[model samples]
Target: MEHSSVHHPEMPHIPSTLTLASRTPTVGSARKSETRHILVIYVGGTLGMKPNSENSLAPVAGYLTTEMRRMRELNPPSDDFAQQGSSSSSNSFSSAALSNEMRVPTFDVIEYAQLLDSSDMDQQDWLVIARDIERYYYLYDGFLIAHGTDTMHYTATALSFLLHNLAKPVILTGAMVPLMEPYNDARRNLVVGMMFAASTEICEVCIFCNDVLLRGNRSVKVRHTLSAFSSPNYPALSVMEAQPFRPRRHLLARPPTGPLAIHSDMSGRVMTVLCHPDFDAESVKTMIQGTSKEAESRLDCVVLELMGVGNTTSTMARTLQSVVNTASRVGCLVAITTQDLYGSLTAASVSRLKKSCPDAIFVGDMTTEAAAVKAMYLFGKKLTAAEVKEWMPRNIRGEVTTVASRL
Candidate 1:
């Protein structure tokens, strides 16, 4: 991946309303916040990508505004769309051009001056989104993130852990295909996501795409289809057809009582190791306990992606015990998660894993993505090793399901 400074020099670290409502495709001002008002943070993604002079598709800053104006569903104007340089900012982006069933919201769109592919995103990039939401927490009733699909689930999971005490909607969305194409789900998904923000009380981080609403931490990128994401170990929060979302209220996350806060501190030292038939104990040892040159080898945490029910080779397990023991002595957490999509670690699995590696934290049913971010979030909070272990398996952000509930 290219360096972030080379790509994102123009995107504001502290978000400012850059696209003017009067001369741009936006509908409202950042300074004004009211009930039913939505804020769209257009973090560069394929939805806004356009053919560069080289004919290769690339994210072009402010291009989404152009396409949105052309779509009568968002601008609702019959005029020459390209000539709408000074269109009214009081306009609404709604389902009118498509349908009248979904709620129409007055919204403001903010774009990064320099667009970067989400594949290059890191903890710092995730921090930017979290901080922006924190600054504008009280301004809008809900939030929408127009992001790239490559890492959309990762961002959703990171945000779920980074933003604490969330009491309003924070929906992440992106298009499988670009809006510049003759036909795509770009406009459709955006309309539906905005409608959810305007009409629902889903008071936590969520991902909405291809008519599927999923808990952010519970979501996974399943395939290249229109619905590229799924909550493999969990249930869909909502599934909308011709009508608006009839969310399973019981599945929705309840809002916390305290005011919203962002956790800015995070340790990127965590690593993910996958267990396989050829999983070498030497490589695992080298990973968990760094070389002699780098003495402090126990990273902040290590996510062990094991086979079904958190099983591993008897030989590898015995070999890993020594390294895990070393990492455990120095405050490094070892979280165990299953490689199977629907797999949940059982008590027997935990018991067996404990015998092999005494310092393992059983992370039942939480997707590998969730486990990784949860580790960084917990470590970022400066939590002690014991506290991190205590919280790893507990359902903090609806990421993990109860074994009893599954039964």
Candidate 2:
């Protein structure tokens, strides 16, 4: 990785040795003798992209490590001020100046490869990321993933399910603009994400963008602007932008009760169906068939993005019902998620589905991405349909704020 002085220049130098060995991909000196180390996993995102001579954004050959260094420099710790403030007994002026220095937490960079548009992300990519989380789950106090905005929600949801019983923060963040722009949003979002992951006591995976911290599975890309992710039905786990970066704390989910279990055996046989205005039975059949055919043998689950209140017209409903039946008969688990960004399925939809597919599990109010990953997670657990049917609706790490009584 090449070094640059463009991001932050006011701080002390980071040892190149650490930069080379650590995945954080930073340019900061070794740790401050006492602060605990925070490892940053740069998996590629808008944060490492910059405009080329042609004026289109492209991945800078070595932006990940450079940005990590800049993030540390821009937010150097406050220990110096503590010494300064205490050294002067009655000198209120010096003490005040010292107090003014921000308490910047130091983070180590672990630069991983895969830094690209989040859209390029797929099942293999997700498995690679999950394996990284497992490989480093014990080494670092927390993890920060810089991803592209396009499919951050899916990754977040996937990680939420893949990483079960997490005891530390796993914050996913990205920007509307590339890191190299003069006034790029990546700097603040990335910096704040590091801070959130380091300080939060929450054990669940989360998505942090703009000033909001959303539950990983609940989050969705609601816009193209810098403030792209949101979970309207659920309150933010925390918010950034406050001085000293105090997370709402209250919104953060409770810490896990057990040790982290990184679920590497996730079943990639999951599929998704969107409930569009023009409902077609053939389309539903084709989608399920295509996914199963493409899998050649792996397909084990499917998720339907039902319309408002989880509704599907009788025609489309029958189609989905048939698809669910087919998938179920083949030992595939079929699940339902509402198209509405914030609500759970209605009793009507649940009842209709129950009569048609009797044994299919519903994802309650969770987002589509969450439903997909959760389905994979359950399938991989090798739980019997009866077992998954019972556990899938429960609030596991706050994935779903509510559960349906009907199905």
Candidate 3:
């Protein structure tokens, strides 16, 4: 695999034989002397896109890494200054001065052969990424993935499950505007992502976009703004700021006890259904029934993105209940999530629907993307329908908020 590193004349010379080490320091000790090595997988996104002949932004091969190399932020400082960088004070360096210093981080970029518009990403693409991380898990301190904004949350949620017991940061970030654009958010997003990846403070999959470090599964895309993503149900793990970089230690995932395990088995058999005012029962029934016996046999789970707080109109309610009941009878998992970005599918919130579809799994406050990816992960494990139902509500990979049931 070919990779590139940015070099500068003013920066201290990096040794060819220099070893990469984790930024994690021993407890009760000062920072580690070695520089952290981060692997940035540029999988094609707005961050690396340029205008096509049609004037629409599109992924260009090798554009992202080239653009990143042109920026001063991606490169590290000279080896001499980096080796001298043991400061007792975290606030000693000004953000402006730090930007030009050699203390930032050292990283390599692996651009994908085929750049994908995030909308084009699917299970196969996710599998490829998961396998690559697993293949190189031991070689790097942390990893950053540059992906398209359209489906970044889905990819992040998939990776959160795929990379089990993650002990290093796997940050997914992209820009709302193309990197080549005169006014774009790409540079800042990429810089912050690199800094976070090189740190030992976070050890789970996350999305850092528009300065917010959000839990991967908790994030949702906000299409209309420069801050393209937000974590509505949870507090940000950290905020990317200028000058002093202080991560919120309390919000980070607990340290993992075992070596990282990768679970690449994802079943595309899971389906997601949206319940709107115009939803029809027969259409849903057909989806549940499948076109034929063979297809129905392969179906394992369904994620229902229901109306606010898991409610539906009386007509829609009956349709959902009937379909859910049929799905239950067929030993297929049925999970419920609310469309409301800020609320959850608590017992009180879905009381009406629960009365008729008692067996449905309630995924409170999990984003639709998380619900879909989690369902796919669970189904891929070939767990029984009962096990899927039980695990769906559990806080696996921090996908959902567990609350005490009022019932």
Candidate 4:
């Protein structure tokens, strides 16, 4: 059955938002779990950076490699670097080799070319990251992406779509502070992210921070200072505490059969418009035209950030029409999403999108980040326009959900 967001007449469209009260830690429970081989793909972020002798920050890839190797050496029987799909007997022997006194799980590190800052990340960066995941997909039981929080959600959501039929966990994690800092949050989060990735209970893309694990597609960075990322319209899969981290497995997507397929052919011909208080024809025209020029081929999709309930001032009506005209003429799709994070916009708020651009798709309640990446991934795939239209609203990997508005 097709699922659309539940409608509220009074609040035609609103963005998703949240203010969560911290939950009390789960008490007095004993649960046992297995240790799986995990791959740590370190792309330079705060977690993988440190201040140098000159007081300049540089990628701490060397530090990560040395520390991890030293840890593995201390525990000679460490099975962290062993390849995946090796026989169970082999894994058992490796696990035993590392299991001298303390039975700690082994992990491997593969540091790619590091990004100076996440802000410099672009389409080419995404491709490299996706290919890295592909290269290690068969070699590791699960994977972790240590990315900058600036665009972690985007990477997570993009990879969720790019890596299809994924049966193992792909967890993205980073910290608010650098690992060199005295009390940096990276240590706990990275360790926990790896643990969660290794868990058989989680079979989807996720972002782990502040000890809480959220569904990748549903997560967004909410606070700059705090380690926690929020899933405004959805609940987290699990929250890791002092002792035991309990995962709500029923909330995650079921794994698909067959080997993992990484789609590196993202069109990168999409645009995202940020909404403001005063929007008009001239401004809208400028944004739409500017983005069109930057596309790889013809523009594929344009995601508009609209005001409350997805509505725009009447002055911008022609702007919307112009987007519809230009996009439709060049075989592009234009969509409208709310600037707000707590509520979804109505298709009626973007009525011109539905009528003028018949093939255009509207993203209801999805973050601008997820919507843009999804459009790029789906644009030139074998999927038809109608299929794109339909799939946009469906929860392929729990990216979007059908929930009633409380507005």
| Winner of 3 and 4 under lDDT | 3
Clashes (N, CA, C under 3 Å) per candidate: 0, 11, 3, 15
Instruction: For residues 1-407, write the lDDT of model 4, one tens digit per residue.
Output: 11122222322321211111111111111212343556677776888787879988777646765554544332344233332223453644344332211123345565653444677776666666666667556645688888888888888888788777888888999888876688888777776677777776667789989978888888888888755588887788987555445577678777687677765477647777775656554664454455545444455577877774323444455456666676665556677677777867555765754554455566777877788888777763646555666666556667777532110
Candidate 4: which stretches are off by over 4 Å?
1-34, 70-104, 283-297, 309-313, 316-318, 346-360, 380-387, 402-407
- Considering summed lDDT, which 10 consecutive residues are worst modelled in model 3? 14-23
Q: Write the per-residue lDDT of candidate 3 for residues 252-365, one digit (tens) a residue.
A: 777777777765478747888888877776776677777768744646888888884435556666777787887876667788888788867566667876776787887778
- How many clashing pairs does model 1 include? 0
Go through the candidates in order and give the C-alpha RMSD of each one to the true structure: 6.2, 6.4, 6.8, 13.5
**In model 1, which runs have C-alpha deviations exceeding 4 angstroms?**
1-17, 20-35, 76-101, 292-298, 309-313, 403-407
Model 3 segments more than 4 A misplaced: 1-32, 76-103, 295-298, 308-313, 403-407
| Candidate 1, 336-393: lDDT as tens digits | 8888888676778778787777678888889998999988888788777787788888
TM-score of 4: 0.75
Give the lDDT ranking, best first.
Answer: 1, 3, 2, 4
lDDT for position 48 in model 4? 72
Candidate 4: 10-residue stretch with minimal lDDT: 17-26
